[model samples]
Target: MTTTNKNIENIIETNMMGYASYVLLDRCLPSIEDGMKPVHRRILYSMYLQKAFNLTKSANVAGQIMAIHPHGSTYSTMVGMVQKDRHSIPLLVGKGNFGMYTSRDLMPAADRYSEVKLSDIAIDMMKNFDKNVVDFVDNYDGTIKIPEVLPVKFPAVLVYAPSGIGVGFSSSILPFNLAELCDGITNYLRTGEKTILVPDFATGGYIVKDEAVFQRINEEGFGTVRIRGKAEIVGNKILIKEIPYSTTREAIIDKVVALNKSKKLQEVTNIKDLTGLRGMCISITARKNTNMDELLEKLYKFTPLESTVSANMNMLVDGLPKVLGVWQTIDRWLVWRRESISRGLTYDIQKMTDKLHVLRGLEKVLVNIDKAIDVIRHSPEESIDFNLQAEFGIDEFQAKEVSNMKLRNINESYITKKIKDIDQLEQTIELYKEILKDESKLNELVIKGLEETKESFSVDRRSEIIELTQVKPVKLVEEVQDYNVTLHLTKEGYAYKFKGDQEPMLKPGDKVIKVFETTNKAEVLIFGSDRVAHKVEVKDIDDTRVTSLGTYLPNMIRDKKIDIVSYSVLDKKHKILVAVYSNNRIAKINLEAYEGSRKILKNSYCLKQDLVDLITLQEDTKLKIVTDKSKLTVHTKDFNLTNGRNATGVYASPARILKKVEVA
Candidate 1:
């Protein structure tokens, strides 16, 4: 055997041992391809059957899956199947609590509460059943029952993954939508090459850089694909708007920090804290001005902010492994789908036709009941024998009976006329089958038949095909009343005092102020000898009582010489006699009296009473002098005499001598 053949055999053996298998060719045995072990696959198959065929409940679908798949089926699995129908496959119809892609915590609802229906897209794809585009498998008990091939209609989208083992290869293909898969296939078909930037599953982010890589994978089964993401720049700062698939938020943050510390991204001041982050929005501020484009390029080249996905088109088929290109996978799937539909349709059509035949025969048998009754009544001795023979098509014995017995008008002969209607019914059944061969033609025939029969199809038929258009509600912005207490200054930078239970702590920037009342009344002096008596009035005191004296005065004095003298009348009245002091000496004596009834105060020393009283003198007085004597001095000075008479220098030779003498 060739080396390749030997390798194939070993791969097959490895697969049988529950290990990875490597196949030399792309095709594998039908049994192996159809026999997938994963619970996810089984669930998906169950949903496809139910949704595509319009089954009503998850429990029902689960029951069917339990019959074929080796794994024990449960309500949860059924729920997951229903979700996979809606999310993994685009054709899935029906609604209720499918899991969320944004988070992994969402588990599908239990089967009991959930309902199932086929989507229009799904129903259309169900046509593949007629085309025999899928394969079927036997039940767990070896009953020929469940479908082995997935019946996907062409131009239809199926987002599903298949898992299996081979000698040296094993793989898990993640789910992808129909549109993207079609785009990938179309690209590959045109250029003999295609590459799909790997999609981020949990986050649903995308990175598309080069189409050629995806195209190459599509055509050649393996290629390296490059994907770049959006990098936004505000001046010197770089902000990454998105990241490539599979790059976690933590991973992105770590990469950024590492790059900054390593000096790969120079002048990065610091990495900010990321907490309670649902999605990442990083801001990379530069300490100094830098070329933004150049920095972004550096980030792409040096950081995990960008990454690549390797497209490997290697999958298991029929227990064998094959490396397939993008086009190859699509093409293979297309062929498989076509064949499965053909076989399924052939089986279903033949079954329906056979049922129609049975019904026709039953109608004929019913019509012959009168003949049967006549034969029994007339030939009671041979009734059992005649009945058996006639029903089993025994002509010889029936002919003898027909000739001898006088046939009653409503007897055996009458039954024969009614039985003749079976031929016409059979003809109608044949016409219906011919029409059903083409769906559009069948639809037309159905409409015409409805008019003729004046009967509507079942409600189930109406739900089979629907026109889908999603209408989203338009959101209107609502005006909300916002209440806020804002501090306003009166051009003096003084805000209204905010009262609190205790005196509020005051700071320079604090916008609130607190005021407290002084315990003692502020005294106003009217005249030196007369004390002004005034009552304090407090107003607008918050959270504190205003006493009659404005506040509680603990250390207030009414008089120095006389203690509460003649304190009268509850209305703060007083009469007192005290000596007025000036310079610590009694300047005058006064009698002061306050009368609350007259609202008047009298002082005997008041200036208005008498000017002489205001000019009163003290009993003892002394003058004090202040002088700097040490710095002063008195001196006597004499103007002394002497001006001596001098000689004349004029006149003579005498003159010279005289002149000289005079000059001297």
Candidate 2:
């Protein structure tokens, strides 16, 4: 049958959605209950089955787990190998060249070269799998069954927080200290209150712990966590001990090299990667008279040594994907623990009942030793099970156990041992029943389990959380030394800076139109024909060759093609004076009105045409204009000071043929 286009469209949409949901729920997001994605869960389960607690070849483990993990390619196997290194709290302990943790681009040795095994933590994560604490599902081929999730007793997720992008969702959970996470979990269990948890990186670093910022981030379950590399100044060297998470030593060194090459960090004389077995050490030697504090701040601003980690607690909850907060995650774990304990007890009680039934049958056979022997000696293997079930009134499983029993001359000691086993089984069953029935007892068991894991696996905090004041950006001017300089702008649009006493040699067409003296730290505003004010720092001008032509004003602001008509050094001690269009209009205003920290502005003087000249107003300020008709106009009091830059002023004279403007 032919399908309609609309029907085809619906099928496509349905299939895409199904695929996306599968990737999101099963493949990408980790379960909030166990803190494991599907592949990670399978690898651990396969390891447990192999009894790989002692060191074994990673290739051997990976080969065994491939039956359960569908996407168990070589790359995935290697990723699993590296993830279990010392960096990730080492759930799977690795031996022999697991690759460089400081450099992510480097690949680990082939699986044949590396050895791995379950750590105490990994063993803890899979402790109760055999006891029916977690659900099991059929493998890809449906021949074998594997666990749906691990019965992780500890806060495994927090200890090794996840980071990955998934279909229609993503996750980036920053790892926290094992001890602190246990404390947080304990606090939540007792009080049902959320606790603030900061990320702790394996690479020791400094975290900018702004409590208010983290409070909002944790409450929202998604935000950025600020972290900075650990650095200190000793003698002439700045030593970087540890870098931010996810940044490699090579990347940081490359960034510093680039910054130094650009002269943005010119104080550095040399850089050395003195990284040794102790830890990451980058020694940056400063030039003489360099400010070490400023260098450190600049490195933090420009290098990967400082970074922000995005925290998104997106994970699987009850087979569905969801984003959860810290307390919500803990509560889900609590619910899972309760269910697991109940199921485990039920599983235990069933096993004990089966064992006691078989033991009781065995005890009866020993008592009727002669009759059992006669029947077993004559009856076939198949008829023995039938005969024992008929005579003893036991179930098929009990009869089978009796038939399979070794003769050993039917001793009395064996019967006595069976009876003792029955008594012990009964006592254990009662204890398990009490644990399942008593809520307090269950809670105590959970807490005890958590404490045991903590005692075994807790490590010292690697990242230090410290209170930081608001980060006011360091001003470049504060780092620069101040000196007096003379700025010269020529009619040909060339800008120059020279020593206050030196005179620059001008080219044939070059004529200095504007000249001003200001400190090198001051800002000079250059008004262009486009009515835009472009700011240039005095120190930015080249002082190497005083006689050479400086930067072109038009090139400074690339988007606009403009000629420098007039310019003025912005100083707060004076008033701004401007002459518009050949001194035909002039105005004076306080400098404070237009003063801003911006480097570019439009329509600075509100001119209808273009600016002619500019200066600072003094008590004896004067202006002279020469008209094209050879007429001259002198004005001082005609144009009064205006508050607004946009306000138009009266023409200095009626001579419409305005020529040139000069300030005297």
The best candidate in terms of lDDT: 2
| lDDT per residue as tens, model 2, 264-358 | 66667788888756766899998666778877887888789888877788878878877777667777778888888789889989999888887
Give the TM-scores of the predictions, in the order they appear.
Answer: 0.42, 0.68
Per-residue lDDT tens digits for candidate 1, residues 77-173, read 4443344322334334446665533223545666665666555543443344444446556655886355554444332211433433444555434
Q: How many clashes (backbone atoms < 3 Å, residues ≥3 apart in a chain or on different chains) does model 2 have?
A: 0
TM-score of 2: 0.68
Weakest 10 consecutive residues, lDDT, candidate 2? 77-86
Every model's Cα RMSD, please?
30.0, 13.6
Lowest lDDT block of 10, candidate 1: 655-664
Model 2 bad stretches (over 4 Å): 1-12, 48-65, 72-77, 80-86, 110-113, 190-194, 361-404, 470-473, 476-664
